[model samples]
Target: MNTPHIAASRRTGFFSRSGVRRLAVALAAVPVALLAAGCSSAKSSSDQSATDVINKLGAVPIPSAPQTQLTPSADESHPQLVAVGSAVAVTLPSGTGTITALGPTEDLPTPLPATMPTQVAGTITLRVATKTGTVKVTTTDLSSRDDHGNDIALTPVGVAQAAATAGGTADFVVRGTFSSGAAQITLREDGHVVAVWDFNIELD
Candidate 1:
């Protein structure tokens, strides 16, 4: 005759084993808890009194602060442009040759303090880094979030001119009627994208 032994695992459900688990866990946790609680040295009588008076007070850190490192600057150097009012223009020189646009270049998530009325703006700037042949150019906007109150215009001011100092030019304009708060401006090219710049606007 053989006898079988059934060992019970208290790791079952709460109703079935929670009490045993609770007891075991409490016993195991006491030592660790005491060790953690004892990590700090006892405060002096003066320090204890000072803390006791402000025990009810709670403090938290301010949100959205910039952190820094002890080394070099982390910003990248690149060509950029900024426009104001209804229309502002910047001209970049490109010699007579073929200019191809590079991959999409953009500014990151700019903090918009306000929206709609503030009319936030941004654009990307590109140069004829390396010329290939006679490259045609154009401007296109695909945000599709147009506000009648805010009128932003994208215009190709120049074409592929075969001159000693010839390149293409473009302009972006933000109208006043914009919600008066914050908005985004995205500028694109015919096939490949050129650049993206961001502007934080506020009511003057």
Candidate 2:
């Protein structure tokens, strides 16, 4: 009964079972390894992207011209101060706070007219501490001007309007393209200049 043929058959059967089990384990581990690798790569890429964004936003350049401070009149209750790469604070009749002009750090892909030279993107944050009641702010309250005394239109990309509490902040994102020979950017609120940032923007 223990012939060579029978012994060979038993050995073959044992090897087949063990090989199948090994193959199954190997197949099961593949997806898990790939998943881990994918997760690690995704996290690294996301972290790098975030770091780039932060660096771009944080390195706001200073303007060429000196910062200007405008009070309008001695009788005026609110005073505005303009500084490059810094937050400008003003106290309104109803509230007091700061306005930070985040200079254009990135060029947007928005379509421009033939007359437009270059389009840039920026953000403006307004923080007001109400003395008595809430202060209402709207998109129309903001404006931009170039060095040539020509007004550069600010197209609102996004806006975050918080409840103007005694002390709260609101933010706005604006996009605009300038003409050739643009030198400075002036920001105005309700027809009065609040902040000015100078730039040596050269357009061909």
Candidate 3:
């Protein structure tokens, strides 16, 4: 029972079983490590692709806008003269009106001087007579333009009435200041120019 041959055989069989267990564990771990490495590589590639797309979008450009032009009407060709103490007659849809006076003044009537002027002051007075039904007049119906085709600012100074009935007369006054250049005053009704007055000045 205690023979050397029998003990040598038992030791060899135990060592062989231990070696087989170790080898099986190592073989199973190889697939798990490879799967983890594959997942890491795929995640890195996806992140780099996303970054490339973002960079491409950032490299694009933009655009801008355009401009336009303004054309004058036919009535702008002819203009009336401005003479001291004289009147210019203008025809309207309902009747006619006389631009009775236009001159430079030091003191404007009450409510006519909306703002204190930094330069000389100018005033325009008109008497309108209606032939048919009543005619409506408003401050917006009047405008003035400078020689450079720029609109001269105007403020309503006074008015006798908003409307003039048939056979009735109404008075209106507007005030502004010139900028050392010629100016043209205009009246518009139904989007058409009814009258235009021209004033030329040369200041010494």
lDDT of each: 0.33, 0.49, 0.55
Off by over 4 Å in 3: 1-101, 104-118, 159-161
lDDT of 3 by residue, 1-204 (tens): 766564322223324664445445554554444446556756476555544654565322211121121212222233344443345454555554443445544343455566644445666665555555665556787788778887777786765335677777776777777656677777667666656657664442
Task: Please give the RMSD to the true structure for each candidate, in Å.
Answer: 19.0, 25.6, 36.5
Q: Candidate 2 lDDT (Cα, whole model)? A: 0.49
lDDT per residue for candidate 2 within 1-204, as digits (tens), equals 756554323222324664455445555564444456556755476555544654566322222222243423211334344443555554444454555556554453466445544544444344333433454345565665666788877666655333365565565556666544544545455566555555544433
On TM-score, the candidate that comes out on top is 3
Q: Mind giving the per-residue lDDT tens digits that candidate 1 earns over 22-53?
A: 55665555444444544557635665544444
TM per candidate comes to 0.24, 0.43, 0.45
TM-score of the candidate numbered 3? 0.45
Ranked by lDDT, top first = 3, 2, 1
Q: Which sections of candidate 2 miss by over 4 Å?
A: 1-81, 108-136, 160-163, 180-190, 199-204
